[model samples]
Target: MAIPAQAPPAEEVVADPVPPPDRRRSILARIWGVYAIRRIVYALSVVWLVTTGTFFMIRAMPGDPVEVLAGKLSMSGLTMDVARVRAEQALAWDPNANIFVQYFEYLGNLLRGDFGMVIGLHNTSVLDHIMKYLPWTLFSVGLGVVVAILLGMGVGMIMAYYRNGLFDHIMSAVASTLSAIPNYLGAMALILIGSTWLGLFDFWDMRGRISIGVEPGFTGEFIGDALYHAILPLITYAFTITGGWMLVMKASTTEVLGEDYVTVARARGLKGRRIGMSYVGRNSILPLIPQVALAIGTLVGGAVIVEKILFYPGIGELLIGSITTRDYPVIQGVVLILTCAVIFTNLLVDLLNSWIDPRIRKEGAST
Candidate 1:
């Protein structure tokens, strides 16, 4: 009724203050925030411990490399004293020096990637030897792992979806059986079945990277021969390795399949295929990524026994040669590389796991 309802009480409109824009963290600080620095420190410590331990352990073995080299030279008709002196000089190391001093000297050279001359390779640089053979392992074993992992993910997804059905049962049995067997056993089996001169198929050569006369280059013909040579060992690795991946994936997928979100996806009218792939498959496969990274790193060492059986010119074979001849520098160099792989892989896995899994990131933040 009142003509002018008493003007609404003068409104006091206080503006809320704007939050200050977040200050950007420095690069190093950002890295530390992500726990990268912590992981790196831990990795470096592990590497140091392993390096020192290996140096001492190898040195502790009775009868030094000099003595072993001398003995070998003696067999080749060199007199004992001459062989001993020659070995000492070729090793370029003083047996009389303190071990701690020698260790520091070795570490220094390692930092420069100078492994010294390899007595096993008749005065070749140990670093040079690694450079030569590392690529072979990288090509064969490394590529095989990639192939196996892809196949594993596919098979695992299918197996999980079929859970307990005919396909799943068959795969589960096969996977369990293969996982229990050592990889080298697969190599041996391939030898028994595929080695042209010795195996059932006798379809391919058991030794050499390419045919004897093929010129070593990027030529198509040479590539074909090398691929032919790699086929059997590659198959052996893939067949045996995929089992573990399949088992892991199946388990992870099964667990994810029962998650509330997965159920929600289905209830929202999503196709079963859509639910499996977009919901369960994506979530389940997250764990495998770290494992795959570790596996790739480990392959740097090459499957030792398998490589031995295959007679593949890989790091494993190089390691064996170094040990047999007591090539101290070469042995240490290979061990150092392997140790780095292990530590680095662990660090990478941790970092990736924390990045990808919110729960892991939360835990890391809390710590």
Candidate 2:
């Protein structure tokens, strides 16, 4: 009876249940949790919308490419019907085709990397036209932005350090006034003050992107000549934009200076230069990163006016000419390129910001 009691004492063990895999949720999280992937999708969607809008809007303009080319041909002694036929053949476009059909065709061509031929210009590629002129705009506007950011940030930090002092007061007023002035007006003022009244440099000499004689190369002479022509547009862009950067930087810097960490750094007996550079300056610059990306788009738009006034042969200049001639292919191509540039820059900046700031990455991942 004791042996039987001992044998009955063995207890059974129970295993814990395993959870099922959430395959659907895991897939969604993998796709959506990635910040760069989301941003790229958004950018691509924007490009598609812009491309669609640009295609329709250009067609909606008063004259069609056929009509415009025909008009020019009619001026050269061809009958209207004959001119239209020639135009249609040359442009390889059909005005009578279904609008939706044309749109789909355009999308197909775009997918295949075909921007189409320039209307009225026999066999000229739209991509070639863009490649030819885009660099000038990038050089002038891009250089101007860099210079303005550097100069503005330096002066702004100084203003923040010397807050309410005479230097600060003077700069604040000047920055406010300059920021209020339109860039085009500032450009005209430069022409009037520097070229017309001051006679510091001849506008005629600096009218184009570069002097005709200078060959395109990495040589110093070529570089100097290019800079000489870009100087006015550069000055206009830098001068007009610098004020805004200064104001923004001054505000950001001032805010950073008041933070507890800055006060603690001062308490720790850190040198003024070290505190300014390492603590205040670095923290203050974060907000400006997004703004700088946006400013690239704004500057490109402004280049239309500035380049037009200055006679610089950039994409802006090309765009203006395309519009004047009702060159739908060229106009569409240019607008598409501009839109892509803006979207690409913003997307790049978003990725860069996420990389630089762990907080952004964390927030994005949770969402």
Candidate 3:
């Protein structure tokens, strides 16, 4: 029995030392790690889907860009054989290539920034056209959405803190009314007020961010002019989107306020301001990130209405114009761009949500 004290029972023996907990990551490091991984995956997936889908879907459309281009070039009068040869040469299209081969070639060219040409747009490269206006659209709508989130979240928090007070009731009524109104209709009314009645805005002079005759480059003057031109449309977008975010924030705050943790914090003799700022604000506001991302993504496309109303030269206008003209390549290209943007935005939201809510990170750790 004393033969080496018999190492006790196996169950009584100390197990291997449990690993120590990881140090809590600095906020910046955690955010960067989540964002970098999310972006890498998002970009790779978007490129894969867009490239393959573009090749096949573009080819599958009822009309051909090459034929459309040739017709616009007045080559419609040529013999069928000549027309066919010309179309092939113009598009560098190969009817006999396998689907995979065509897809690879299309992706290769896209990677090289050769986005082909718009058929009726007089030999303008799709990429070139997009580059010309994408920035304005992103800036206008993107800034508008930021303004919306601020207004919505700020007002909603105020209403939520007030609970059943007059401000809350008023906001509830206003949100209900605005949520039912379509964005285009709201935009139309804003346009009538700002552009027609007040005469504060000029709709016809829209070209680039600045006036039509402004220099064709980015400068402080150009940026200031563009921001000035963007103000009306930005206001319209902010107003239109505010209702949804406000409602979301209000509901989330109300729910979060009722939680036991909040009550416990209050019982700990935490001041109203401390509880509101730390417990209520942190928990309730997380619901807004995804909503903000979605709103931003949606605004990227829906900005067309406001753009048309304000006559701003942006990607939204380009999309509207492309649709009307049935410029398939350009339309498809823009759709692809917007789709990729949305997907990436969504991925970012998911990653951000995980970061903000540690339960998600804990679950990931267990796996």
Best by TM-score: 2
Error of 2 at 226 (Å): 1.4
| Cα lDDT tens digits for candidate 1, 282-348 | 8898778788768867666546667777877777788887777777787887888877877798889
Maximum-lDDT candidate: 2
Model 1 residue-pair collision total: 1
In order of appearance, the predictions have TM-scores of: 0.81, 0.85, 0.70
lDDT of 2 at 294: 71
Instruction: Indicate the residue-level lDDT of 114 in model 2.
Output: 93
Q: Write the per-residue lDDT of candidate 2 for residues 1-367, one digit (tens) a residue.
A: 4654455666777764743468667887788888888889889999999999989988888887888889999999999999989888887567689999999999999999999888777778999978899999989999999999999999998999899999999999999988898888988999999988989999998999878878999999999999999998899899998998998999999999999999999999999999988999899998788778778777886788888898889998999999988887888888888888788888878888788787887897786
Once fitted onto the true fold, the runs of candidate 2 whose alpha carbons sit more than 4 angstroms away are 1-26, 258-270, 278-291, 361-367
lDDT of each: 0.79, 0.88, 0.73
What is the alpha-carbon RMSD of candidate 1 to the true structure?
10.2
Model 2 clash pairs are: none
Ranking by lDDT: 2, 1, 3
